[model samples]
Target chain A: MVEVGAHATAEPLVGASDWDGGALPYRVGHKKLGMWLFIMSDSLTFGALLIAYSYARISSVAWPRPFPFFPSIVFSSVMTLCLLSSSLTMVMAVSAAKKRDKKRARKWIFATMFFGAAFVILHMIEWGHLIGDGLMAFELPEEWLKIWPGASPLFGATFFGITGLHMFHVFSGLCYLGIIALFIKRFDDEDVEISGLYWHFVDLVWMFVFPLIYLLSIKPS
Target chain B: MEHQSKETKFFNMTLLLLAGGAVLVAAWDVAVSRFRGGTDDLFFVLVALLVALLFATPPILFGIRTGWFHEKFVIDDEPPATEAAAEAHAEAHGVEGESHGVSNRLFILVWIALLGLTGLEVLLGYVQLRNDLMLTILMGASIIKAALIMAYFMHLRFERMSLVLTVVPAIVVCLCLMLILFPDSFRLFHLR
Candidate 1:
């Protein structure tokens, strides 16, 4: 039996030698492992918000899905496409790093950064439209209150909370990628891959969000 | 004891075989649905073929190369092995093989697949399908997309099995939590 303390001493753990890192069993660097672990917990946070939002959706008979069929869906689809393209570029960046082509890697990194910022801008515009329709994070708009007095206020709260958190992720991911770009020469291929992992994760979460929030709620024009 | 290691190996291999079968069925199911529109006859055929292949693969490989299924070599401290021997042992088992390190080609393929799937998903949203069927398509497609991003872009494909275990368990737990609360979601709620 290999206890935690045995790992530090001469005592042998049967499987420990198979993996890398003297004290740790990590095959990847500790930093990369830490990023993955962070992503796992962050996903749960989004999951909880989505679950609560679903609860709100199922509980009410008439949730106000105020998105215009053509305009809203088109904007969102474009945003989704932008984010997805960014993921491709992120992959390109990592691939370039693997080949030790720093110039091409920097190009891909900048391209990814552009798309990330583009998604944030698009999202903020969508938020503007929603707010124009009286979608406040905390308070129900007076116009909406007049139409449905008994409506649950939880709808807007969850919508903004979930999507807002995801937008925050995009923002932070851009910053993280930018920092990686600044010190691209300092880090190994794994660091670039780790940052790419975070970028794809943000993109992945939107894969679920885009369908559930937009496609499912599309009302026939 | 050597006996215990063998038992452990068998147990782990069995678990792996089962997992491999599950991935096959899932991918096959998705393919059948997306390609064939999920006809029941095709499903049965796919299932039968997949099961046969799953069962036959391990035994065939084992017969061809005994000790191929053995766990990666590790140096226990009872009698220390030389570094050269340890490297040779690790090399022979093929356990340290990195999947993505093969080339950038795999990641490119995965990227194109993701874009194609996203396009398919968007196109299906406009099609007049049953709500349940549409939901199934969306969910299945989303799962594949997520898996690809994790395995390739995230480089989980190249990471050791322990890191895979670390991230996957959390996702499974979250999914189970969602399932537990799923029943409540179906119930009608009244606004106060």
Candidate 2:
């Protein structure tokens, strides 16, 4: 075990209110900190859209609950599984990178990409089914209107907007992982960890999206 | 050391202008809402402006870091003390070892927990509780899931307290501020 206070060259700032503890506030590289900042801002973007959607749902007298249990919910649940699995793989990739095991890290990164691509493909299929049922960005399907005559058309917009943006992120994450995997020799473990942070962030966003969008709007049997 | 490459300067300036413009527009929206007696609109618009200002901070911070603003603004970033401080603090707390090379089993455990929570959320959806009740439960569960993924999968749990403090609070506060619109939903519902 490393000795405590062995390397404490000066007196430690034990209880000072304004003590920064160190010159490096976060003890992270600039790139990692930049990614954290990006995630923070990007979260607000999603947060605004999500809050708007929830507000609309709550305010509307007749918001359409369009997703059925069999196909829509089931398919989305599977997609959730894919994302979760991908997060696990991403963690493994970072661990491998930290160990300087380039081959294992690249393999795990590819695995993560595979799951991410699968999620996107499944999401596209789900969107295809919705569109084929006459769902549009600005318009809801006739069937939904038949059930809830006063349903807001904004349903389609929020649904597609939020999920589409998430899907784009997943797709971009795949591309980002691909770049890392292809150039694993050049990048360091910290680089891998930073990318893993982005990937986990994508999964984290979906954690809210899945339940709020899919579960809340489940169709009556 | 004070000089920045042309590319870095261009990128910083562009981000500054973009975020600055968003803050301006959002602030205008808030003002219009307040003037019109639209409290609900004001809340959301106010939150939007906060988000815009939050977004603007990173670029301004970057500018300060890279000495784009002024040399006076840049703090002394001497290396030896900072590195030694970090290493000593990490060593004292035994944070260095666990921060890296976390076991795969722990990650798999977190994965299973996330899956179980997702299943629970789906089942709760099927049970048909009251709208607000169900929404609360699902969001609670989702938040737990998000925390797990962030802490374990993203290794935030292994990170320094400073980083955790810096990252978590900002997002949590922003999200909570947005929730000021929640009660306004009932107001809108009543109006309808």
Candidate 3:
């Protein structure tokens, strides 16, 4: 039985040790894998924030649904479209890089950055509308309580906290793509793919943020 | 060259079959709602179908990139059997395999699907379901979209299965652990 156990363990030990000596045990590039690890940790960070926001929301007597359909919801939906388009453009850029079409890849990368910037600008405009309505980080607008009595002050806090973090990620993704696009000639295809991973992840997070934050809170007509 | 063992092949095929079924169901749902002629029914159907598609498309695309569906189209011109040899071959060649590399068309479809899903989410918002139900549906749709982006656009599907196993489970386990705190919120709600 001891010999049997030793034989069973020996196979996996050999397999496990393959990654120890500079070999790509996962058959993935070190940089790409490293980025993936970063993304995983970042996902947890966002996940925790989202969970905390949800907790505050459910526990509160009332959460403000300040976004009306006309400007807020429509604007955010357009923003979602913009981010999705950027992800498509990012894919184009990655595929172009893989094909060694540097010029075309650079063009696509710029296109992605353009869309990402558009999303940020649109988001800023949305924030402008909210702040103009007196929605501060810690204070819900006085009018909001008229619509939703007992509205939680935490609404503004969580909304800004979550969406602000997402917007920062979008802004950072734009800058990251800009740097990659500028240095397209120097960076290899994997770098482009890695950047694309980050870009897509930004879009991925919006998938949750848009619905939970915007759609869920659409003011009843 | 690495060969897919019979069990792995079977598992992949099973995943493909389920994805195909999901697509068919989504199409059917849309058609049924169209025939019903209620605008609200249409919105409900579209939202429901989007939910199904969110779960469906990734597996099919994963299969395509892994060359499970179109294996016959793969040009397996062999030179040697080492991993380095494969890497060098891929370097010399543009892509590892033409059929195995996910097509640009597939990504566009995914993009459109995402947009359609978002549109449906908005439409569902207007439908005025119960608050709990609406939140549940929205959360479900968002998760599906995230999964689609991660699987296709991020190329997690093309990566080694072990990487997917590692990254996905870690996130899932962490999320599950966090779920234990949910009851605390309810207690707070009652206290208020």
Candidate 4:
């Protein structure tokens, strides 16, 4: 391995954080840097999944509409509302941490946890309803199978794959937030901030997911 | 222990998580198929649920003992030197020492806007406009909402340019990936 002491001083690359004993750019905390990078890559993951899902929709002749008209949109809208509300609570948690008000931060984190968990539960219920409608990730319902006998299996695969992956994120985010809640007294604003970043990203991804998955697919009555 | 932003290190969970997720999806597919296919075996569903429970445990354990992300990234928990670094960071962002620097009322307002946008989108979904136009409108509304959350809720506005630059490539790469979908659209139109 080349020793860094060889040059003792060379121009530091861009985006190098001072925390890593380097220089220039990335002056933020490790959590912030890590969280930011994670969000960036995570966003790309969702982007790729969404693009693939749309591609499948386009490539297929006729896709199944198992989500059931506008009611599914309404349910998902409420789910979106829960997540948006959780974001506010998450900000409140960070803001409270900034004030050194651990109690308020704890309260807000608890509230955020409640809201995030609520979204997941609502989401699971929505998924169950869709499943009850005879949708499976790898196979179409017997009804759909009869009509579009040659429809691409990708429709179901991408639907479940993309949405399932997002649901996993939501679940992991909730667990992360819950863990943060358990130790709110020892945490700081930056901790709350990073947690908020992850939570908001989940919300942000859902913002697009809601429109693309539910709204765009609404088959008019 | 200041870390460089240019460093190519990561706490990579992508492959592991993807593998786990794909397994869960397979389990889900199996469970659904068995249920629908008349097997009545709930083993796959149980496995899927077990995976979720297993994933939930790590973060809780991470909380108990500060994990790699916290051990490396959190600055304030360090010595006075890092505390000074934190202060310098706050000053650089013009957010030094004002607890809850952003307006709570404004945040609530943004939340309201998000809620209202959700309502509007849901309503618009009911309108049977031309397909492309409807998708465009819905997409536009969602993008606006995402921006609101990112700028205000996630505090990206207060972050530095370096952090902002990180996201630029993600978006650009996302747009580039859309090319993969282009060739198939013709088949979509003609094949049906």
Candidate 5:
């Protein structure tokens, strides 16, 4: 950590009550709170996208029905499981760090990172299959006479746009986890726990996306 | 100490039951798929319901296993001086000291209720329910699951009520804005 005076920065008032084992006043710090506020704002961005999606769905004449062709549940199911398990490992990592079990914390962090990687891989495969089927991000596959007779471009556009944005977030989160895991030794217990909080937030977001983007779209077929 | 051990056992049993529920649902899917060839859509709905239930089970289980659900940050039972000291320490540090003994049995019951909701949704889908009805049921389930997670796993239930209050308004406003604004935009675009 940088020395408090090296940068000649303004510091909070130092009083006898503020001294607590050489830690900050709160168990949480300003930096962590700032990150959370940023996340909350970003969540609004997603909420807007989803709202736009719902609007598009409501206004469109034909939606090509959202299930069966899209989501490909088997692939998504695996990915969802991977992300969920990563959350469990992340919580375990935080628990270990809180107990000051450095080795266990590192192991759990690595495990969480591994699961994150697996989730990204599965997502890539799902996207590849969709693209291979000619479902372009902005363009839809031509309506087949027999198969997918009612398929429309809007389906591809909305599906890709929503899931693609989510994928971007997932990839970014994976990178974040990987970077943190690399410096696991450097983080204090509190810092490690804060990292875990971010990881859990990512997982929590996916919990919503998995159902909304994948499972809810499943039509009877 | 014995009570703690018993609680632990109860929690473990709850996890096992949830896992067993998932396995049973999966087995049912396999069996029905093999014997009944024409009910593919029904089967898919059943499987989807099971998956949603399975996804929701873990967070509740985590809260139970971690003893977070019933954990109290303020110790009302302690002597006033000790309590005051702890409260002062907590306030100074902006931390809420919590009791570690959470009731696992309560979590298990919550999980079971969630699973039941999932089952209800699947049954509704099977009975040729209206799309709006089915959607509302599923969304309701999602809301319940989200609430369980935020309250239990995230420990929002144990946190300062002010912090909790601060979050809900933001969520509600965002949701309302998205739901209302998008449709209006689409309607305007259609006119163009």
Candidate 6:
């Protein structure tokens, strides 16, 4: 009891001063950390799908030639371009938000969502054409009889599995972007930046997927 | 904080250029395929890499030339006291202080190297290089690009080392899982 009152008074001052001066923008919060953790888990999910695809590819006799079975490169290329452009727009939206230009931020975010929607629509069209040609996950191809004539079901299974999963992600990401854009009008700068992180991450994942699924497997028909 | 608006123009210009380049590349790819044989997977990969490089290059270069690369988002240590109080109330834990002196020239150089390696990948495809060698080269380019984006654009290089330490281990573990699981699947198919 000799000096306890004095020490208690001193402690509050130190704590208050520390609280007043030290804070950062783009700081990690519970929500941000949770989102990052979710992204990490999602990365693992994609990793598993990619591993499965690789295993099926390595073990299959007479792997299906992706060039012929898939739609023309031109169509997929356009879709890829759309997605990439969306990434750029997303960065711009983030930059705008950081400047506290909510109006511009909303515009750029809408642009990003638009591009994302275009990508999903194009993918849907491609899937429709492919399904019409007797291609689906786990479905054995009739063309295998005419082409390789000795191909295994693993070829089609892995192809559709990996690409279809990626497509599902693309669709979900579009929806996410759409919702984020809608909220842009009300969100503070920090919140907008947080949403931008997720949007950019989605774009980044697609950047890897475009090459792996669509580009890496293409050989001469 | 004050520098944000000044940099916005540069960022917007870069975005426009990237969008334009993407459209051009898509059109060119389509046009080239009509006259020659259709684009293959390898070719498409090269094109995509090229587009990424093209999109990433201008901001890095312009920032370097204009000396804006050294600018940081957090311009001042003492923000409005009220905002600071509110931030503290929220208990947002982020890196304090501004990031400065990020080397834009170095980043651009890295982009160039990435693009050059992509070109080499395309050349290798035409020169009939072995598949393994070609893949190795292409993947190497991809790694370099990823490193540049993470270290520079994402500012991981300047941030807390702990963040990098945490994220990298997860990525490596994911890669290992891929390596292990893929071969097993291949063996089951009897292709391996």
DockQ each: 0.21, 0.27, 0.26, 0.23, 0.07, 0.09
Per-residue lDDT of model 3, residues B1-192, tens digit only:
034445545665675676566567657867676646443444445444444454444455455555656675766656757543454334333344422356677778789889989999999989979988998899888888998899888877565555776688678756756765665776777675
The TM-score that candidate 3 achieves is 0.74
| Candidate 6 residue-wise lDDT at A5 | 18
Query: How does chain B score by TM in each prediction?
Result: 0.51, 0.50, 0.50, 0.47, 0.43, 0.44
lDDT of 6 by residue, B1-192 (tens): 233344456665776677567667766766677535322423453555455554555455445434455564333444536542344322223323221322234434444454454444434434555655656665665566556545543435543333454565567555654563343543465443
Q: In lDDT terms, which candidate is top?
A: 2
Q: What is the interface RMSD of each candidate, in Å?
A: 6.6, 8.5, 8.9, 9.8, 12.8, 13.1
* CA lDDT scores, all candidates in order: 0.70, 0.80, 0.77, 0.70, 0.58, 0.56
Task: For model 6, state the Cα shift of residue B67 in Å.
Answer: 26
**Comparing 1 and 4 on DockQ, the stronger one:** 4
Top TM-score hit: 2
lDDT, candidate 3, A1-221, per-residue tens: 00111111122333333333423445567899899999999888889988898889889898887788879999999999999999999999899888888899999999999899999999999999999999999888888889889998998889889999999999888888889999888999889999999999999989988888888888888
Each candidate's number of clashing pairs is 0, 0, 0, 12, 0, 2
- Name the lDDT value of residue A139 in candidate 6: 66
lDDT of 1 by residue, B121-187 (tens): 8777777778768878888998899888787667565554445656785585455556455545554
Worst 10 residues of 2 chain B by lDDT: B83-92
lDDT of candidate 5 at residue B147, scale 0 to 100: 71
**CAPRI-style docking class of model 1 based on DockQ:** incorrect
Which ranges in model 4 have alpha carbons more than 4 Å from their true place? A1-24, A69-71, A145-151, B1-95, B178-183, B188-192
